[model samples]
Target: MDIFEKVKEIVSEKLHISPERITLESNFKKDFEADSIDLFELVMTMEEAFDVELDDDAVVGIETVADVVHYLQEKM
Candidate 1:
């Protein structure tokens, strides 16, 4: 799968949401009810899945799945 699909899968698994419900417009707080720990776990999960450690700047700016995809694509 492509980066976007992989990201969606990660988010879906982490957040316990359907892939259809996760969109570019989906907000983690407002839409998914994800708390701070959820985001933290997501970061660690993404790091494991992609086999890359995130820097402070990359971790701080990720506000959406698209941001994660862009960050991973850049790193890869």
Candidate 2:
């Protein structure tokens, strides 16, 4: 699957939410109600899935699904 699809899958699995509900504009904290720990776990999942090192500072700027997708795309 592509990075966007993989991201949606990871977010859906971690947040226990449907993939359809996770849109580009959906904010991790506001839309999915993810806390700091949730975000951290999500980042770790992405790191493992993509085999890349995502810095804590970069993760901090990820607010929406689009943000994560864009970041992963750039990193990859």
Query: Which candidate achieves the best TM-score against the true structure?
Result: 2
lDDT of each: 0.85, 0.93
Which tens-of-lDDT digit does each residue in 1-76 have in candidate 2? 9888899999999999999998889999999999999999999999999999997888989899999999998898
The candidate 1 region of ten consecutive residues with least summed lDDT is 57-66
Write model 1 residue lDDT over 1-76, tens digit each, in one string. Answer: 8878888998999999999988866777778998889989988988898988888777877787777888999888
Report the lDDT of model 2 for residue 72: 90
Model 2, position 3, has a per-residue lDDT of 88
Error of 1 at 17 (Å): 0.5
lDDT of model 2 at residue 56?
81
After superposition, which runs of candidate 1 have C-alpha atoms over 4 Å from their true positions?
none
lDDT of 1: 0.85
